[model samples]
Each structure stands twice: as C-alpha cells, then as structure tokens.
Target: MAPPLLIFLIMIHGVCSQKENVIYSPSHICALKDSSVIMNCTYTYPTGHQITKVFWTKGPVKGVEPPDLSEDPEYSQRLQYLGDKQQNCTIRLSHVTLKDSHEYYFRFITDKPDVKWTGIPGVTLNVTDLQVESPERVTEGDSVRLTCKSSCTLTDRATFIWYRNSQPLTERRDRNNELLLQSVRREDAGRYSCAVHGHNHISPAVQLNVTYSPRNVSVLITGSGEIVSGDSVTLICSSDSNPPALNFSWFKGGTFVGSGRIYSISKISSDDSGEYKCRSINEHGEKYSDAVTLNIMYPPRNVSVSIIRSCQIWAGGSVTLICSSDSNPPALNFSWFKENESSAVGSGQSFSALQSGRFYCQAHNQHGSQRSDAVTVTVKGHLVILYISIGVVCGAAVIFMMLVWRIRRMKKRNDTHESQMVDSRPPHDRHKACDVELSDPVYENVTADQLDDCKSELDSSVYENLPHNNKRL
Candidate 1:
C-alpha cells in the first residue's frame, strides 16, 4: 500500500507539470473569406517523453481515431503544417472558405495513443468578404475616391491593389489602401475593385457612373439643296453624352421656335428660309450645334406687266410691254401672250405690238411661273377717210346752229321794246356755254386716227398703272 501511494504521488506531480507546459495562444480567431490565416499553436512535453508524430484535428481525441488536417481532401491543398518537433504547432491555411469555420485542436503522439492532447476553446473563424466603398455616380471632370474595407481589420500592413474591369491597374503613385481619381472622364466609368497585394481575398466590384454634358453636337437634315415652298421638311439634332441629354431646343434667326430633338416644318414656306440651330442640355451642362442655313424655293409671285407708252393703244404705233415678277431665281424667263390665246405670242422680258389686240405677260422661274392681267389695244384705219367723215358731221351741226340763231334774231326785231326778253338771266347761268358764245369742242379738228393716240395714253395709264404723259397729236 505504501508503494502504490508513492506511485500515485509521482503521477499527480507529472500531470500538474504537463498541464502547465501545454499551450495554445489566442484561443479565438476570425478570418476573411478566401484569405489566408495563421493559427498560433504550441505544445511542450517532459524531456524524457519522445514525440514521434504530431498532427492537428477538429477537436480533442475522445475514444480513438482522429484525422490529420493536412490529409483531408478538403484542406489538403490549402492547409500547411508549419510546425516541427521543437514544440511549435503553428499552421497556415490558404484560400479558406466558410466550411473551415470550426473549432480546431493540436494533438501529439509519442509512441502512445493516450499521450494525445488538444486545446479547448479553439479559434472562432468568421469568413467575411471585402467590400469596395465609393460613390455610385459622379459627374465628368469631377474627382473621385475609392476604398477597400472588410468586416474586421485584416492587417495594418496590408498593401492594396486596384482593378478596373478585371484588368490590373498598376499606375498607382502610392501603394496605399485608397484609390484617388482626378477629373474623371466618361471612359473611366466601369467596375472597380481592390485587394491586398498577396491575399486571395478581393472586394466585390462596384459599378461607377460618370455623368457628362452633351458633346459633339450636330444638326442633320433629311434632304439637301432647295426645299420648295409647301413641301415637308425635317430637322434633327443629335449628340453624345454620359447621361443622356434631357432637354433639346430649336432656334431660328436667334429666336426660340420649338422643343425636342426633332424639329419638323410642315408645308415649309419662304419665311422659313433662315439660319437654324439646336441646343442640347443635361444635368451637367449644355451644348449648342453650329448654325445651318435653310433655303426655301418658290415660283414667281406678285407678277405684272407694264405698258411703257405715253400715248394711245394703237395698232400702227409701236408699244412696248414689260413683264416683272418676284422670285428666288429672279424669274428665269418672261413670255408675252395675247388675250384668249392658249399659246404664248412672244418670248422675252418685253414685247412690241404692231396690231390691235388684247395682251398679257408671264414671268417664269425653275419652280413655276405667273401671268399678269390683260390689256387691250385699238387702232384707227385710213386716217384721211376718218377726217372727211368728222368734217361732214361738224358742217351739218354748224348750219343747224346758224339757222336757229337767225330765226331767234328776227323774232327779237319784230317784238317791241316792252315785249323783249330783257336778257334777264341769273349771273351763274350767264357763264354756261349756251348763254355765252363758246367754241365747238365736237369739231376740234382731231380725227379718229389722231384720237387713237390719246386713247392709247389713257389705256396705258389706267390698266397697267404705267407712267405716261397726256400728250395729244
């Protein structure tokens, strides 16, 4: 009984000494997703006990069998046993996933199964991912900043690497954790991410948007060259920008006319002929396109004919008729036509009449033509015969007047002084042609042939509004 008691005392002393020797530091640990981590583990045994094998397990070896972490298929490629017989049981895990979040222990076998030991309250690993923090949207020409963050501090000495659209960005001035972008452009908009220099963990990509004002603005027309009046016309304004332009305005002759990217002028007229442009605007700024000139085509308008004669409209006498019109091309041609005639009588800006007829003129351009109102011309034939006829009529009227005057004088002589008319007349009536002796206007010695000249002068002035003088032959 005394020998047994001494052996029990030795065993008790050995158990207490070994308990103080075994060690596993930092009994708790957390790691980032897909990141490598170091598990600080160590163990010390009595000098006499030889350690033949060392392995790590999920937990304490309760009954018998325990597997090694390095041999497991799930951890074979990623687990590294960086420990040795010197009592260092440290381990390195690469590309750790969430499945690795289990309590772990260290075991030792010195040619005895019972010598195995494990540390309780193992590291608690939480697989968290890195996140990229930045502004979701920014205007062009503005500065931007980006950051890489994790749920917990991975390491104070962690160096960061940035990526744009899955391509490595190596033009960094400083090897810091933040990325600075100055005066960002539209081409700089894309997905961005960051990661530690050598760590497998990377932040999730974040999309970046760059808003910019309109650029490369221009105006487009559906057709080129002359646009005829009363024809449909279309004008379009277009531009490129990061954020699409929301407002479009159209201007003509420096005056606001309409709104929209498309400006349509239906049944275009001559008034629409002018300089036109468009303006594109967005949240950032606005841009204007170069002015474009619009040309409207039209036919001759406000057409009329001029009779350039100061005398009467006569067949024997030469008279000139002029055609005038308003047109864009200045009326390419002019034509003279007689009244009630389908075909033109003459072609040119002016025409001379040698016969009695009704005439009109037309001015023509590329688009169309216009005709003026008609004017009539009359002429006297056989001048000597016209003069003889006028003389006979005047002689008869004069004889009749002489006879009546003789009869009236005889009657007055036969009457006494009291019976006489007394020549009593209103003073106003005495001025009449019949009361006083007057010249006979009917026989002015102007024949019909001469009257033709006077009639022509009147016709020229009255119908054509032509300039003329009242000259009589």
Candidate 2:
C-alpha cells in the first residue's frame, strides 16, 4: 500500500546497499594420506571494491588475522592457488598428511581501508591413514576377522587388499574393509597389514598369534648306531607347536622312565635295552613319538655248559654237551676246549666227548667272549672197566711190597744189634727177642731213600708176578 515513488526509492537503496560477500562450496572434505585434494570455492563482493589480497588460512581465530597457509613451512611446498582473487577461490593441497587436517578459510582484503572479509564455516579437511585391528590371540581352527580402519570414511570407493608377513595375499581382495579367515590354521599366523587398492598407503602391521597342539613329534638318539653297554646315551624329544612344549616325558617300552626335553642314561647297561618313546606336552595338547629300539651291545655273560640227557641221544661212547650264554644279538659262534688245553678242540654250540675229560665252551660275539666253567664227562665202557681193575691190582701190590720191605729192614736192624753186642748170654736172649719181635711188628719213621728202595723192589716183584701180556699195566 506504499506510494510508487517511495517504493522505487527503497528498491534503489536496497540495490545499492546489498553486497553478497560469501563463499559457496562443500564445507567438508575427507582425504587419504599422502594424496592431493581440491577445495572448490567462489566468492562475491559489492561493486567498485577491488580485492587487494587473497589467501587461504587454517583455524582462524575471532578478531585475529589468520595465518596464511601458503606461508606455512608445513604446507608452502604443497599448497597451490588455482583460482583468481575476484570470484574463484579454488585451491589444491598436495601430499596431505594427518598433521594437515584442519578447518580452512578463504580470506580477502579490499582496496579500501578497514574493508576485509573471510568465509565463515569454511571447508573442514580430514586426512586419514590406514590402520588394522585384530585379536591378540586366536586358537587354531577358529575363524578370525581383521578390519582396516581409518579416522574418517574415504571419499573414493576402495577395495581392500590383505598381507601377511610382509607378503601380499593375492587371492584376498574385497570391497569391504574386513578380512575373513575361515577355520584359520597355524600357518596363517604372522604380521598382518591391509591396504586400499590403487593407493600407496598401507596400514602398519599387527602381529597375529595362533596356538595349536603338538605335531610331528619325534625322538632323536645322540650317538652312533652301535650302542654298547656302559656307554652314555641321550634321547631328545622334538615337536612342532604354537608355543614350544615345556614338558616332556620319556617311556621305555610301556613304562615311564623320565621327564625332560633330553633324557640321559649314564653308563647304560643291558637292562636299558628296549623300545623308547617320548611325549611332548603343552597347554593345548600332547603327542607321542614313534618308538625307537635301543639295541645295547654287550659281551657274552652267564656262560654255562649243560649235558643234554636223552634216552635216544646217547651215541657210540659220546655225550652231547650244549653251551649256553646270554648276550645282546645272541652269541652265534662257540668253541669247545678241554680243561687244560690252550687251543679250542672243537667248534660250535655243542660238543661230543669221545674220551673222558673235563670240557668247557667259549661263547663269542661282536662285543667280547666268555668261557664257561669246566664240566667233567665220564664215559662207561669195557676199556674203562679193564683199566680200573688194573689200577686196583697195582695199588694193592705196591702197598703189600712196602709192608714186607719195612718188616725185613726191621729184622736186619735187630740182627745187627745182636751181632754188635758181645754174645755171652746175649745170643740166647737175642734169639728169643728176635722171635718175639717177628711175632709183633716194630714201627719207625722211614727216610726218603728207604721209601725209594722199597718202591724199586715192589715194581720188580709186581712185574714178575703179573701175566706177561699185562706186564705193561
């Protein structure tokens, strides 16, 4: 309802006073690390006002002149102005880092004194680096997931690539940021990292630990193949596990013998010869190793000769004697010998004694040899009986001759004594005493010479008395 002239005047005044001094563009930007970003902007001002200075400043404070980004040491080399000072205020920030993230404002100064302007609610830049999030530990055979994280969502559509132990996983690529592992195994444990495809930035690595039970358990013997008795031996238990097995148990056959990573037998004996195994244990589980035989070589022992008695085995004046011994890798070679002979008379485990004598057997093995105690073998035959009879007759004859010689020597000594005494009444007395002495025998100690002379006389008398064919006996 106002007048036309007043309305025209108000319109002219409004048109003259109206000034659009503002910036138009996106107010927020999300950028990748070490990459370039563009800030599209435009500005306006009242007519007849020329821009004297134009620059970009970050984190502007109220009533304070914001520091120009182009002059800043951190951004000077990377900042570039791409638009004119009048309208376009676009800018490019190259090689942006996390430290470059801040609110930025486009500022301009007019030629007139006290005339300056700054865009309010300016562009907010957010620079982000990749990071990986994973579990600290995972049991084997369990599914696992890892995520690639950033402070802000990336502006570009990205495909994630995974890596383990610094090696790229060529088969694992997905549009999502998560890496899924199905029924994970121990081999999958390592330093894990993630990256966006077509981007140079990669996340820092994180360690992934996988736990499992023992596997490939085995026992190793530290020595040569020839394990002789009295030699020291060691058995080592080894296995593969997520965490190294700290407990180990040793078994001899089915009996538990010891517990340790290394089992040592000092001065091992024959009793130690058997199958040995080891068990490797950890928190996860345990596993047993394959059994290994400890063949302890030793010398022959407990050697003995036994006479085999059998009704049908006795043959032709000979008896079978068997030699037995105890040894590892049983003694195969045996030698038979007489009691007093230095050389072996026969060879083998058994021996036949044709003649009566004391016999023994020697058992031989790689380690050493041993001989058995001597055993007496007696043979019964016609020749043996005849020899026994001869021996008896000869022994009796020698004793009878010795008695007669002693009696005669005593009679001679009595005769000499009677002759030496002057026989006055002595002859009749001596003759009477001699007859009494002959009836009762006188005893005395005989010298070696006397015994020798008696033996000589007895031999002659026995030979003459025996039959001519048996004289040699």
Candidate 3:
C-alpha cells in the first residue's frame, strides 16, 4: 500500500507539472446571405489530452440545455465538428442566411478530462440583408425629412448612420437607432439607407421614401411687359424638382400657348397682347403661377416732325429735321422721306436737310409703324434774289456811265460851233485887224508922191514902150 501511494503521488505531480495545450479562434462572425463564414475557437490542456469530441450547438429556445450525451434535436444537421483528436478547432459555415444566424456554443471533450468539457466563448453570427431602396424626389426651395429604420432589435446602445447615394452621413446616437433628416433640400433627394451598430453586429438597413411638390416656380420675361409688333420676345418657365425631372408649359388667355421650357414670340404684334401664365409639372403634382399681362403698345405713338433751324441758310447751311415718337424699346428705325420720292433720307432719328424739299419722317417698331405729319421745308431763295439785285445795280451803273459820256461829247461839239460863229463875225472887223497888222498889203501902193511921179511914169511908160527907152530924156 505504501508503494502504491508513492506511485500515485508521483503520477499526480507529473500530471500537474506538464504544460496544458491551448487553442484559440474568433468568437464572433458576420456574413451575408449565400456566403461563407469561419468561426474561430481554441482549447488548452495536457499534450496527451486528445480532443475526443468537438461540435457546435445552437442556444435552446430561451434557456434549457441537456447535460447527457443525447444531442439537441434542433442542431443535429447544422452543427459541424471541426477539430480532430490532435489539432484545429475552427469551424466553417457555407450558404448562410438569416434563419441560420444565431449564437453558437463550441463544446470540446478531451481524453485527459474524461467526462468533462472545454467550452469557448459563444459566437454570435450575423447575416445581413444588403439592399438598396428607390430614390426620392423633392422640389426646389421646399423642406423634406427622411427616416431610415432598422429591421433588427438593437438593445445595446448603438450608433446609427445615414447614407445618400452611398456616401456616409454623420453618425447619430442610438435613442432609436434610426437615420433622420430635417429640412431636406433638392440635392438631398436620392437613394438613402441606415446602418445600425450594436452588440458587436450591424443590423439590416431600412429605406426611406420621400416625395414632394415642385417649388420656386417662376416665369421670366426677356423684354418689358409692353411689346410691339415685329418684335421678338421670350418667356422662360423654371422650377425645382426631385430626380431633376420637370415639364414646363405656357398659357395665354387661359389657353395653352406653347410647349417646352421657353415660349418665344418671333414677331410680336399688337395681336399678341394677352395674359400669360406658366405651369410646372412633376410626379408629385403640378403648379400654376399667377398670370402676367403683356400689353403690346402701338408701334410708336404721337409721331411728329420738328424743324430745328429756319434762318436764311446758305447753299451749304446745315438744318436739322428731328423725327420723334414714343415707344417701348425705342424705335429701331427712323427715316426721312420726301413726299413723293422712292428713297429714304437719313438712317436715324434726326436728318440734316442740305437740299431744299418737303420732307417727312417715319418711326417704326415691332408693334407697328408710324409716319410723322408732313413738314414743308421752304429753303429761302434770298441768295438768288441778292444775286439778281446785284446784277441789276451793275446794269444801272453801266447805263449811267454811258449817258454821262454822251453828254460830254455834246458839250464839246457846242463849244466848237460857238467858236466858228465868232470867227464868221470877225470878218467885218477884218479891216481893223489889218490896221493892227505889222506889214502892208499889195493893193495899198497906188498913192503916188506927186505929178513928177506921173511924168516919170509917162516917160517910163514911153521907155517901157520903146525897146531900150531912151535914158537920155
């Protein structure tokens, strides 16, 4: 007996001195449907402690477990024994689903701890239902709120997060473990989901469906409220929508006027005047705006012509003729025309009248056309009259010169005639003129000196009669 006691004590001491074999694996797993998953667990004991039995068991409904070798009927087929007698205690599960998801308890029986068991921490398996929800719609300038609820019961304090079209939103506390939004905008409208984290597991997401009416619907005018004939005008309709989808239509005088986002009047006329309205439609509903009136005024009103200057203008004098009218958008074209001419003068509102004529102006716009009351431009002919008067004065001056020359010639002739008359009278006084002469005339020599003169004359006469005349007498 003493020898047997010593052997037992040695055996116990040896057993206690040997190190235990230990194994460890993951105690929790998360997977998706139709996917594979691994459950990790390990055990510890002496080197010769062969792993006799290794199997997984699901939790009993609420709480009961049998202590004997009889297997629980519910986990018979799904349970897998992964560890062999020597090593490897991890398990792998295939074709996972929500129904197969639960807490699994790993039980291992070793040869050294006969009839006893080594169990690791139970692992909770989570099978997620990953799916996307349909997108939502929201109008411009309106407010919306979306909520994402979880399909699982999250008892532990969990963090809830939201996503828009796959982008993560700010995390939220787990009061209800739901994603929430306040005053959502058009840009916030899109695919949304919620993620819940609790009990070291994530719950499946819940989708939020949001729909709203169109907002900020408005109509814009390209021009003023008053339009004219032959003028171009544009009316634009705009609004905000979810999915960026919208239909725009225009109406005039309670009747459908045009299609598309903009309604254009190529040639606006007086007949185009009426009340205009715009309507925006979406999947949510339709919205109509208040009507705006379009009063097409006469092309131009009160067309009149004004003469800027009327002084005695020279041939090159500049005179301005102004054509004026009242119209919206100003008159595009202003032209001056002679009463019966085929061409237009001056391409603008005012024209310089260089030539003399009767001129009129025309003011035109898209609404209509107007002709100014005819204006008569009487270019003064004073210059021509002045030229004529200067010619007449020059002709008068030439006639006066000719008359004075004729009078001077007559005066010279009269003086010559008077001198000849005086000469004819001088003949009676010719004897007196001879007495005054310095020399005697030949007829005055007959007065002799005495009778001797006569005797001598006789003797001379006798001598003269004889050939030589006797000088001796």
Candidate 4:
C-alpha cells in the first residue's frame, strides 16, 4: 500500500485529467430551413496530449466511434469546420433543411493510444419552416387576426411583418407573432404573409377572402336624361361589391317596371316620363340608387278651335272663339287667322270676330306648332223682311207683263187664221159678194159705198186685234 500523501496526489491528478476532457457548447439551437447554421463549441484536454483528428458526428452511441459528418454522403457537401484543433470546435452548415435536425457531438483524438474525447450532450439543432395562419374567409367590417407560425420555436427574437398580394404592409409590423385588424375593410383582404424584421425568411402567403354587400349604388344614363318622344334611352345600374350583384330591379315612381342590370326604353313616350330608380341585389344584401327623372318631350297635337259664343251668325254681331290643344309643356302661344289672308287676324287663346269670314287657330310651343280647322263666322244686316217685300212686287209685275204679251200674241194668231180662211173661201164667195153688190145696183149707189165702208171697218178690226206697238210699227 502507498502512503496516504502519494495516494491523495495520484487521485488528484486523475480528477484533473478527467476534468480536462470537457467540451462546452449550447445545449439547444433553432434555425431556419434552407439557411446556414453555426454551432459554437470549445474543448480542453491534458497539456501533454496532442490532438491528431477533429471532426463532428451526430447521434453517437456509447462504446462506439461514430463516423464523421464530413464522411456522410448527406452532409459531406454542406458541412464545414471553422475552428482549429487546439480548442475551438465551431462548425458551419450550408443549405440546411428540416431533415438535418439532430444532436451533434464534437470529437477529438489524441496522439496517445486509446486516448479520445467526445462532447456529451452536444448542440441540438432545430430546423424549422415558417407558415402564415389565417382564416379562409371573413365578412367585411369584422375583426380579423393572422399569425406567423413555425414548426419550432425560433432562437432569435422576431418582429413579425405582413404582406398582401406580394406587397409589404408597411404599417403592419408587430412584435407578437399575430397581426390584428380592427373592423377590417375590403381593402384589407388579400394574400397575407409574415417574416422576422431582419431575416430573409418569409412565411408562405395565405389567401384572405372578404365578403361584402353592395355599396355606392348609382344609375348611369347613357346620354342626356332629357329625351324626345319616340327616342331610345338606356340606364345602367352600377355598384361596388364582392361577388358582383347579378340581379337588378327598375322602378318608375312606386311601380316595378323592369328587371336587369340595364333598363332600356325603346321608342319612349310621355307615359314613360317619371322618376326612376334601380335596386341592386345579391346573396349578401341589396341597395337602391337615388331616383332620376326621365323627361320626354313632344310637339303640339290635337289642336282645335271652338266658337264659345256663336257657331253661326245671322246678323251683325261679334262672336268669341277659343283655341285649345293637347301637348307636352302645354302650348303657350296662340294665333287666330282669317281664311284667304296671309297675316294673323288675332293673337291669344281667345278671339272676337267682327267680320264675316272663315277663321283658324294655331297653337305654338318649343317643340312644334299645329293649326286647327277653320270655322265660319258671319256679320250681316237685319233687312230680310223689306228685301222679301220688294222681290214679291217685282215678281208680280213681271207675271202681269208676260200674261198681257201672251194674250196679244194669241189674238194676232186668231186674226191671221180668220183672214187666211176668208182668202181661201175661193173666188166664188168673193164673186158672189161682188155680184150681190152689182145686182143690188138699183140700191147700188148707196150699197157700193156702204160695202167700201164695211170693208174699211173690217181692216180696222184686224188692226185692233194686233198689239198697239205692232200697229205703231
């Protein structure tokens, strides 16, 4: 047996030697995938022992020498050593992936036989991937929350940033892993992603869909709202909403007129003139546009003239005439014109006629003018009885004259016939008259003279049967 002092000194040397083989390193580390990672380490050994080989190995077992990471096909290309064999055992790994997650050990071999050291409980590397977590859909105006998630806890303190549609949301930087939106609007909806402030690793984007009702509902007229009759008009209903509104209803005043996004009026008339509006509807909700007026204009029509006082005149008197028409924007101007005259006889809706003539009325408006058929008006004196008396007298006088002339003509014709008969009485009748006169010769002197007297009397009687005027000729 050795002395106590020697025994104590030998025990002390063994303790010191055992303590010198220790390796120092972090117990745990978290790193991003597809990125570089560094494992910091240091080691101590006995002063006389010189290291012959230094390398890294993973998942080492007791009583067995593990193969170097550089020798492994999976890690050979990415594993690198950055420290000397004396103390530093730092290593760098390039293009790390989640499959590389494992506990690594730093191993060194001394020049002496059966002399080696391996770090126990070495750095535990955690390879993690980032992902964005969000709800699939949300209604507009509702609060929303999105999170930047990871498969493992990050070793570094991170500041979360958000992105929408590949564009960074500059004001959405948050210390927490979550992004909060109060009363989210439609503009806030898009594909979202997150990242640490200083790291290039960004989470995969998540789509955030937002549903909303119609807004800013309005009707657009293709042209001027004011139109003429028989013209076409178009109105389009427009609104802002998600899943655009497909159903639309049109209204004229309080009545439902049509259905569609576009309301069309072909050959529009005055009856179509009114306040119109449109209702836009969808699965979400509906909205109504403010009313708009569609004005339809037309020319004057159905113009007419009426004699308010007298339609016909018998004597000299004035008559009142009224003009009227049916038209949009009622005819404001009126004119009365006499037939066969180029100028207007009067101007107004009413006219007084003082002369005998046919008159017409014309109604005028901005659109057009129309004329009414002429009406007859007369002015005459009241001398009808006196004129009738004079005509009767003249007619009687003419009848009397014609009767007298007819009588004279008949008397003259009778006389001519009697004279002709006497001549045709033959010579015998005439000789007998002469013989009678001769045989009565004894009475002759007186008789022959008396015959001459009688003959003269007969001639005078014929003249008397003729008209006095004929006797004068």
Off by over 4 Å in 2: 1-25, 44-54, 61-66, 84-88, 108-117, 308-316, 379-473
lDDT of 3 at 192: 67
Better candidate by lDDT, 1 or 3: 1
Candidate 4 runs further than 4 Å off: 1-24, 33-36, 49-82, 92-124, 164-172, 224-226, 306-356, 361-370, 378-473
TM values, all candidates: 0.59, 0.69, 0.42, 0.60
Q: Better model by TM-score, 1 or 4?
A: 4
Task: Provide C-alpha RMSD values for all models, in order.
Answer: 17.8, 19.4, 21.7, 20.4
Which of the two, 2 or 3, has more lDDT? 2
- What does candidate 1's lDDT look like per residue over 1-473, in tens digits? 34777755544333224332445566556677887878887777766677887877785466767788889899889989998976798888888887787778676777555565544445555565778899999998899998887766653357788889988788862466688899999989999988877777667899999888899899999986778999899999999986889799999978999999999999999899999999999878899999998878899998887777745333235677888888887886988888988998899988887677999888888899888888876544554455677788999989967865765565355334313332466544533422222123422332334334235334343423312221332
Q: Give the TM-score of candidate 4.
A: 0.60
In angstroms, the error of model 1 at 117 is 2.1
lDDT of 2 by residue, 436-462 (tens): 432342423333342332343344554
How many clashes does each candidate structure show, in the order listed?
6, 0, 14, 1
Writing each residue's lDDT as its tens digit, candidate 4 over 179-213 gives: 88889889988999888777777778899988899
The TM-score that candidate 1 achieves is 0.59
The order by descending lDDT is 2, 4, 1, 3
Give every collision pair in model 4.
Answer: 441-444
Candidate 3 residue runs with Cα over 4 Å from true position:
1-96, 99-159, 173-176, 182-188, 196-214, 220-234, 241-266, 270-321, 325-357, 362-473
Per-residue lDDT over 335-447 for candidate 3, one digit per residue giving the tens place of the 0 to 100 score: 88988997997779888877688898889987667888888876556765776787899999999678657655654664476456546766556434333321233212211
User: Which structure is stronger by TM-score: 2 or 3?
Assistant: 2
Per-candidate local distance difference test: 0.73, 0.82, 0.60, 0.79
| Model 4 local distance difference test score | 0.79
